[model samples]
Target chain A: MLDQQKVFYGILGLAVLATLGWGMSTAGPAGLAFAGAASFTIGGALMCLWERSIVRSAFSLMATFCGVGVLFILLGADFVGMAQILIYVGGILALLLFGVMLSPPDMTERKLVRVGGGLLTMGLGVAWVAGKVAATVKWAALPIDQLPEPKSHAEEIGVAFIHPEQYVVPFELAAVLLTVALVAAVYIARRKMSDFVPEVASQQENA
Target chain B: MLSNITTTAATTAAAAAPSENVVFHLLAEYVPEGVPGWILPIVTASISVGIVIALISVMAMGFTWLERKVSGHIQCRYGPMYAGGWHGWAQPIADGVKLLMKEDLIPIGADKALFMMAPAIVLGAIFGAFVAMPLAPDFYFADVNLGIFFILGMSSLTTIGVVMAGWSSNSKWSLYGAMREAAQVVAYEIPLGISLLVPLIVAGTFNLREASELQGDFYGMGWFVFKNPFMLPASILFFIAALAETKRAPFDLPEAESELVAGFLTEYSGIRWSFFFMEEYAAMYLMCLVASVFFFGGFESPFTYMAREQFGPNAFITNVVAASTLIVKSIAGIVLMMWVRWTLPRVRIDQVMTIGYKYLTPLALICVLGAACWEAIF
Candidate 1:
């Protein structure tokens, strides 16, 4: 099973690399972006299917995040791309792995079971979305040639967040929201002093 | 008169343009025209990767030797003196050869795929961070606009590698080490990033090369560490946070030798173990380079006249001087780290968190705020 999985991933990785190389030679940045997107989506799906281990699944998620970051970089959103990696891989994934590791062993080891009817429904839903996207979008009419030269958006985004005429309010609101969430999370995770006191008293009475 | 003006403008523009001496441009000249568009970038990338790998390997070997000697002197003993005659100059090489010949081991019931992939991921994260590092004015792989941010982001990926290694090892010790590493990295990263922002705020740029160039005046006095009163504290904060980030003592709880028996490394053997070791030293050097770039005059010498005025006309000389200066400064930073490691006792895991969250984080935040105000006022 391990060897089979290796072959599957090996082929997938090679295909992605080949696509990336071809795209770079022929269609340039747009091709690379497309290839990155395809690799992330397809590779992530395959990893989810092949890996029974939850921890390995989390690693696949990190790869998907990295692919998204690559797409952002290709689109000239360098700051966003880095932020994607920092926030998703560094912050979220670490928390996720910690949670997984700390959880009950049995819960962590449960294999992903597939339901036949659910798979059919998921496939149909995906097909419908693809059809809708195809119908609504004019892919051939994209102005690939007219695309502007790639440039960094770091300064622009930074200034925009603080500029009164730009996204200042939204920026402050986001900060406030994050602070609130952080406080709430700490509140939930913290061990209450009152509960600890009661447990200590019970232990003392037993002694 | 118009021609004179045009000629002067042209000269200025030429000077402002990126130097033709950069590795990328040099590689570009070697490619035959009309061959293929992708071939140039591919070739350039391959060469850049080759150069970085070779440099990193040599540095790793040198650092391992230095570390042993440092550790030996601190303990009042000679370390590896016989490996290559005087001072064990060839000790790392011998160790590498031995490691290569050693039998590779996989523990029973270990996840083979992840076990194999972990080291590669760790090394890849470390190498990717090098992409944005400007070794000299004309000696970088890529000068991304968000260069510092890119490095920070890539460095964070190492946590995933650590987690993978620990879990895949199928050992209690490995799991403990991995968890500790994950927690420590996540904790330290906040202060590390916030402290880094002080320099970014002062420079008003995220590009490391630009930041370094910004400090290329005042004969090194203009470096960010001395730019403001707050900057000195900020640099110290960054260094301490960096120590934690690299898992150097007193923050080396993850692999605490007295406690976890090499921690996550308990299961690793041979070349696989060496990969982790190399990555550690490489990361230490990378953080040192980052420190020099952010706080000290990166490639710029204290004697600005020598770096900028005298040798400015010769691109090659200027690049070489700049590269040497940066390396020297980085080595100094590495030595400082070693000094701290040998001097201080290891902190417990809880104390590490307390230092990171309660002390370092708030101090860094205050420094950022102060630096911003300082910039605005003066």
Candidate 2:
């Protein structure tokens, strides 16, 4: 009389427990940290898939982003971690939630094709990132074995961004582009109210 | 030579070095070596959590008491004089007990999980932000190099909780409240962070301790506002944005009583209802504390300088004085917020957006530009 869902969860829990024990025996703290981050990411994705409500699913997506932020911190990129949370969770997700108007549309139909397509895309992405990047990329930032005795990652990043021979031009260009994009967004979003409420096309478009 | 973004190369170089926080050091120094090494961090973290929770609870209680008293005095009456002697000093405690004893309710139509989780998220986000707040130079939960930015991000995360609380409530008023909270926070966040940059440019480092220590010159008269001309205006802008950020008067549209019927808390009750209030008071204190550290000399006062001079620099007496000075400055800020809250009427949501986007954002940017120029030339 066991529910299928309960049985699945129980098995999954047992597998996780066994793996954690084995991993701890072999890899110590690194294994534990990896396991924790993986749990957060995978759990978020699972919840995102299992949830019926769109708003809840979006929150689960946020959880996934948060996990990624934690991973960035684990990799010694504190500035990037904070920035990711600030930009993604704080800025982007807030706007998305606002746009949704805190309302979830009732979702009754589940398309098999969409699910299958999404799974395939995700699997392919994981393979491409975890496989090629690990094997090919030369990490000049810091080698794992000779970790620099803790330095201000923020300072390092700030220097890299503004370094004359490095990223200064690209940084400034990105800033200018973002500013232009912001202005354009505002301009387009404005209702076509003209001077003295005269006409619809008498504003930016008319000009 | 490197561009002088932050001054004092020795200090800046040392900032790059990692050091265990005070609590960790204390536990390591005192605790027996027989305990497993891995459990030490867990113990340190739990202790920090315990301290922060206690501090927050006490501050929240005191704020509730002060709010009532301030409101009553503003209206020419005594508030809660009967609950405890001396103007109902125990009123907050009484309220706490009542809230704790009350039955929890969830609307039948409410998303049960979200309904339960919303308050936790709201409270949890604030707690995470508190990690970066340094109580004294030597005493803090964490010595995060990106302290202020980390706090700002965590506060932003609280918006999700507010929205969830509203949406999960299954009430129209809660929905309205949530939407308002998101919009206000989004609009004001730009000005809030930008205005803070006016002082950050002068201080160079985002470490709250470093910022405070730098201002210990001229008998602690060396506040950032004194060093930079644009800082005063920027501080004013920051204060305005902070008011909106914390949803205090003239900006408390999310939970405006006259219009939204308690806003996001329409369906919440008991302890769950109190968590939102706790977050509000804590956030207000945090914003004020940031202001004190950034613009007003955080932990730097004539009193603290004297204490440091009297006792050794790292003496407990100096720390005590410094802690009190910070608490007092933050209290002054809270009182100012309360005064404004009682004095000014709440603005329309449209007006809030207009003010945040149109006025504050531009002014903040101008201040930043002026500060930058002043820094480069001076």
Candidate 3:
């Protein structure tokens, strides 16, 4: 009754569910439990729904992100919740949409390589071990209620960007990375647009 | 001072305590108090949203009419007339109705879902910026502590939405326009964020109310705009960058009628196009509002404090003067944007890029340094 692949995925799902439940219990009664249950259910369902459609997969990923956002909200981290929505839903989802547009028309016919059964088993086992270790760690023993109210998390982050601790370097690094990406995108777009220029130029000159 | 402390504590206790507590307390003060605690928060939030929406909509409509009149006069034509018994005051309403009644069409090959989502997204992002904007003393939605960052973060959503609309339409012109918009907005955001930093650095807090309050007394132009000489230029630079980012007038490459055949909006018609128009107008007002609040002293009348000193703490007079002055200042900024839009010709796309990256960026960096030095020296 137990196929090896099915058993591996089932164990993985159960581990994620258990960890999520523990987090939800500690997260208080502010819809975090709902978010956790929703995410687990959706993520589990995505495995069954994985098909030839890229849009479907993208939607599933988006659902997972929405759950993460709710969890952030439950933690009373409204700024983080908004950021999660802005970045993942707005930016990453748009990027995925672009990916869908760029993918070959006959996506269903294209043969995609699958991992070996042994590798899958090994990965699942490693994940299981990691989860076990994480579960045993007494994270809840740390104080949480004493945390100061986050009247303005964004303000704190902004100040941290100026102050030389925790975030200044990383903030600069994000800027640099963004600049690099901008340059690369411009270069690629320019190169692509220029490919048909010779014919258009000759026609213009003739006219 | 003694009474002030008691009132503050009472209000705090009122907010935190159960509705029953407040109701009983108020009942003790006057009539039978039996209201619930949660009712207070719900009532406050609802009233806040209602007031904010009402004030913002009225102001936004006025700005729209003013822009049209200004543009029409500049072009040697008559503008709105005979609405609300004056110069065509109700023209925007008529236009809205016309747009609403127009046919909504969807192209066969277009990505229907995103095409619909794009304008909605743009409106949502721009409207969201209003939450942190303060009108008068004790008037704001939410009073977000991280107001500056929240504004920036919310505004950035427009870029994604514009890109989606352009790409989803499956039209060549729209795609090109969207690409240009993305490039332009992203480029300008750097300088915009940098210019904002000059004020943030001076104010030492991202809270808009705190920043405004720190600008010294009312009536004095003791805002960040006047604090350091460099801040004036920095504020101007920020406004220019905002105009470009919002794709207003000379920087409106996304819908440049002369070049790209209406650009990204070529396919959109009727109410959909009006949605884009509302987003643009709203963003223009928001930009001016941010400028006024950050650089100029927000909601501080030029003569309010003088009047207060002379007349002795008349709350009614103080509020009226502050509201009027704030409205006038914000309108002046909006009018200035309109003038620039009508007066200047659209810059070429390449020139636009060059100006934004080459000139604006270096100038913004110089202003940043100048501002820091000004702070140090004086």
The TM-score leader among the candidates is 1
- State the weakest 10-residue window (summed lDDT) of model 1 chain B: B1-10
Q: What is the lDDT for B188 in model 3?
A: 85
lDDT of each: 0.78, 0.81, 0.66
Ranking by lDDT: 2, 1, 3
C-alpha DockQ of every model: 0.42, 0.41, 0.15
CAPRI accuracy category, model 3: incorrect
lDDT winner, 1 or 3: 1
How far in Å is the alpha carbon of B281 misplaced in model 3? 0.9
TM-score of 3: 0.73
Name model 1 segments beyond 4 Å from true.
Answer: A1-33, A103-115, A144-148, A198-200, A204-207, B1-21
Candidate 3's DockQ is 0.15
* TM-score attained by model 2: 0.89
Model 1's C-alpha root-mean-square deviation from the true structure amounts to 7.5
How high is the TM-score of chain A in model 3? 0.60
- lDDT, candidate 3, at B321: 67
Tell me the tens digit of each residue's lDDT in model 1 across B1-378. Answer: 111111111111112222232565787777776786545554555566567778888998899999988888888988789887888899999999999999999998787878988888887777767766888776677666677877788788888888889888988888999999999998999999999988888888887778888887776557888887788898999999999888889888878889999888889999999999898899999999999999997887765437667777237777787888899999999989998999999999999989999999999999999998889999
- Per-prediction share of native contacts kept: 0.55, 0.55, 0.13
Off by over 4 Å in 3: A1-29, A32-134, A137-148, A153-207, B1-47, B50-55, B82-85, B307-317
In model 3, the Cα lDDT at residue B138 comes to 48
Give per-model TM-scores. 0.90, 0.89, 0.73
